[model samples]
Target: MDHHEGLRETYAGEWQGLTNSEIRARYPEEYEAWSRGEPVRRGGGELATEVADRAVPVVLDAVDKLPDNGTVVVVSHGGTIRTMIGRLLDMEPAQWERFGGLSNCCWSVMGQGARGWRLLEHNAGTLPQPVIGDET
Candidate 1:
């Protein structure tokens, strides 16, 4: 298991430790943009791209060290994981919100592919069952 401080969640700035209702009540505009998946300065906190910029290099460095078909388990905060996955798949930062947040202790699986990195699973908690008889 590897740990990096860059894998921490996007800093919530003054909103840290506040409940969603409290944040919504206090910063309605920022909360609205956040709920709508629009990129807004998150209370002068780090942007998604900024999170990716710091975290992606660490992830890529780890990936580079892996042997062929090797696996690495990365444990990270929900937003940071999403940003890293989006960046790995070459998705624009604006589309990072398309990926949903992960539940506590849930995880995502990614694999390198010919085209680039591919996400085999996202926000998953259970082991995947193999397809049977073409049943999807």
Candidate 2:
């Protein structure tokens, strides 16, 4: 149960922890660019790809440490989780928005398949049964 600092939430720079309204008021252009899926670094912070770059390595490291059939649970912020999932699935940064918002107290699951990593579930409320792997 160790903490991994790389799993922290997306660093939004000046927009860190700001609400939507607050961000629109203070950084309207940046917010609009993000809303339009233009890949703007909100508050001049890390881009989505950058967030994935930092977070995915931590996730992969945990997976590498697991014994055969072992499970690793990751608890992280929504934006970081989403970006990491997108990278694992090999989705382009432009496609990250296709992954929906993760509501409070929800979680997502990913599984390693023979092909690669696959999303088992997303934004789920209940604790999930661990996916040993997807051999098929």
Candidate 3:
């Protein structure tokens, strides 16, 4: 997810870390189109969509290995979390872009059930709500 190309780091020769305007000024049309679905052929870099594809399988593989009715906690970045949610909801890759971008220290709980993966609660932080026990 975040560690993947798009979010990881830009590797374009002379274009890395530059703003879009700077890239356009330096790299011309190729960089300008970077935001509008431009594919970073081979060594350039990967698009955000590509990163999600690489992340989904890793998450699913871990889930599959868990015992039925088992719970697992995934501590990761916003991109990784959103991508996982999109996969759980059976969303298309395009739709994955629309997943809620949760904040830091936030989490979403999903469950595997007869109806397949179901989203329980979204962005639940470590709060005392919905619980009776607390440090006395």
Winner by lDDT? 2
For residues 82-113, write the lDDT of model 1, one tens digit per residue: 99999999998889888999999899988765
lDDT of 1 at 75: 84
Which residue pairs does candidate 3 place in steric collision?
none
Error of 2 at 71 (Å): 0.6
What range of 10 consecutive residues in model 1 has the weakest lDDT sum?
127-136
Model 2: per-residue Cα lDDT over 6-83, one tens digit each: 899888889988888999999888788899899888888889998898899998999999999899889999999999
Q: What is the TM-score of each candidate against the true structure?
A: 0.88, 0.89, 0.57
Task: Summarize candidate 3's per-residue lDDT along 1-136 as a digit string, tens digits.
Answer: 2233222322345555688677767667675455454454322664545665666676676778888657566666776667667766787656665557777778887765566776667777863244343222
| RMSD in order of candidates | 3.1, 2.5, 7.0
lDDT of each: 0.84, 0.89, 0.60
Q: In model 1, what is the error at residue 135, expressed in angstroms?
A: 18
lDDT of 1 at 103: 95
Query: With candidate 1 superimposed using the best TM-score fit, by how many Å does residue 71's alpha carbon deviate from the native?
Result: 0.8
Cα deviation at 63, candidate 2, in Å, is: 0.5
Clashing pairs in 1: none
